[model samples]
Target chain A: DTAVSQTPKYLVTQMGNDKSIKCEQNLGHDTMYWYKQDSKKFLKIMFSYNNKELIINETVPNRFSPKSPDKAHLNLHINSLELGDSAVYFCASSQQKTTTQETQYFGPGTRLLVL
Target chain B: DQQVKQNSPSLSVQEGRISILNCDYTNSMFDYFLWYKKYPAEGPTFLISISSIKDKNEDGRFTVFLNKSAKHLSLHIVPSQPGDSAVYFCAADDTGRRALTFGSGTRLQVQP
Candidate 1:
């Protein structure tokens, strides 16, 4: 059983296409995050949701939107894809910890290729 | 601007030796540090972490050392095995912020 999972492990599409990547966590976490690993292999935070509410939105493009229907699910929708958007996206979950540091569990990344 | 930096892009070590990976951060607000190991085609796995209050934390054969003054941290793997070969990432977080800033990963290869 996967603690965190994403659908369409591999996505190949042409530029200007619209696609969505779905993420789910079964670990009963209240916080979820989306990270993009660019060609340089730097994992940067795109968005974060806590208890199904938007909390952190980095300086990402407007085309990328994140929606959390519930605490267990967070989905990312890209309006118009571009060749520069080709990268591996990862979803992670963590139980909010204020006393000590909390560890984030990640799901198998979805490698998106835009031709 | 890259807040976190991993100077070494790749590292190689012999089996049964020690492997050290270094990371430096420019954000002084970051008080919590973590190390994550990732293999190709897989997500990063939580390895170990240390709070700014402490200088070191260890689990199994993995140990993490932090120097707040230097704004630097390092991960040490003792008796490095071939299975330990993977990309190691160093992450830093602020005291209250749950978001993490990750450094450019260092690929470690343990030769047999």
Candidate 2:
């Protein structure tokens, strides 16, 4: 069984369109995160949620929003997508909010292409 | 600015040899470091990690060395195998933030 799962392994949409990526974790983790990897392969954190509450919000644009329905699921919704938004989005989860040796488990990334 | 940096874009090593990858971080608040190996179209898998209190951690053939004074860390793979060929990412956990800052990955190719 997959510990972390994301839907639509690939997504292609026109610029200015809105799209969503869904993520679910079966590990019963309380903290979930979203990371974006650009073409240059620079991985950056966009958002982090702990117990359905926003904990960390990076300098990402407001067009991108994260919604956590429960502790096991966190979904990302991007509004007015731009060409620069084309990147591989990864969802990850960690058990505790603050652990020195905390390990994050990631899902197969969702490659989004904005035309 | 990038808090964590992996200067090497790519590295090549012969199978059964030793492969070392280095990473540096500017943030002193990071108390934990990890090394992840990623394959094409897949998420990164945790290979090894080290806490600030420890200088080294080892698992099987993989070892991670952390230097808090120099703000540097390294992953060493002894007898590197062909399956070890993948993009290696260095991530740091900022104390109390619970968020990880990742460095630009280094692609390692282990020639058979």
Candidate 3:
């Protein structure tokens, strides 16, 4: 079984369009996170939620919003998609509330291409 | 500015040999460090980790060494096989932080 899964492994869209990427973790983790990997292979955290509570919020664009309906689901919605938004988005989950003891499990990334 | 850094972008190693990947961090508050491996079109998978209090951690063929004084860490893989080829990421997190800070990444290719 997949511990964490993401919908739409590949996404190709036009500019000014809105899109959403869904994520679910079956590991019963309390924390979930959204990360973006750029073309340069730099992985950066965009948002983090613990038990459906917003926790870590990086300096991401306001157009990108992350919503967690429950502890197992976290979705990312991007408005007015721009060409610079083309990258791989990954969803990750960890068991405990702290990062010190929890090892994060990630989903197969969603490659987003904004044309 | 990036707090974590992986100076080498790529490394090539022969099968049955050893592969060493290095990482450095500038944050003093970081208490835990981890190594993650990622194949193409996939997210990173946790490999090993080390706490600031300890200097070394080993898991079968993979070993991670931490030098708290220099704020540097290294991952050593012995008898590397072709399946070991992937991008390795170094991540660090502090006690209060819920998210980890990641280095750019280092790609390793093990030739068979």
Q: Identify the candidate with maximal DockQ.
A: 1
Q: Write down the TM-score for model 1.
A: 0.98
DockQ of each: 0.82, 0.80, 0.77
Model 1: colliding residue pairs: none
TM-score of each: 0.98, 0.97, 0.97
Determine which window of 10 residues in candidate 2 chain A has minimal summed lDDT.
A95-104
The sequence of per-residue lDDT tens digits that candidate 3 reaches over residues B1-112 is 9999999999999999999999999999998899999998888999999989899999999999999999999999998999999999999988577688899999999998
The C-alpha lDDT values of all candidates are 0.95, 0.94, 0.93
- Could you tell me which 10 consecutive residues in candidate 3 chain A have the lowest summed lDDT? A95-104
Q: List the candidate 1 regions with Cα displacement exceeding 4 Å.
A: none
Docking band of candidate 2: high
In candidate 3, what are the lDDT values of residues A1-115, reduced to their tens digit?
9899999899999999999999999999999999998998888889999999988889999999999999999999999999999999999998775334667788999999999
- Candidate 1 residue B82 C-alpha distance from true site, Å: 0.2
TM-score top scorer? 1
On DockQ, the stronger of 1 and 2 is 1
Report the CA-based lDDT of candidate 2 relative to the real structure.
0.94
Highest lDDT against the true fold, candidate:
1
- Per-residue lDDT tens digits of candidate 2, residues A7-33? 989999999999999999999898999
Instruction: Give lDDT for model 1.
Output: 0.95
Query: What is candidate 1's lDDT per residue for B75-104, written digit by digit as tens?
Result: 999989999999999999885878989999
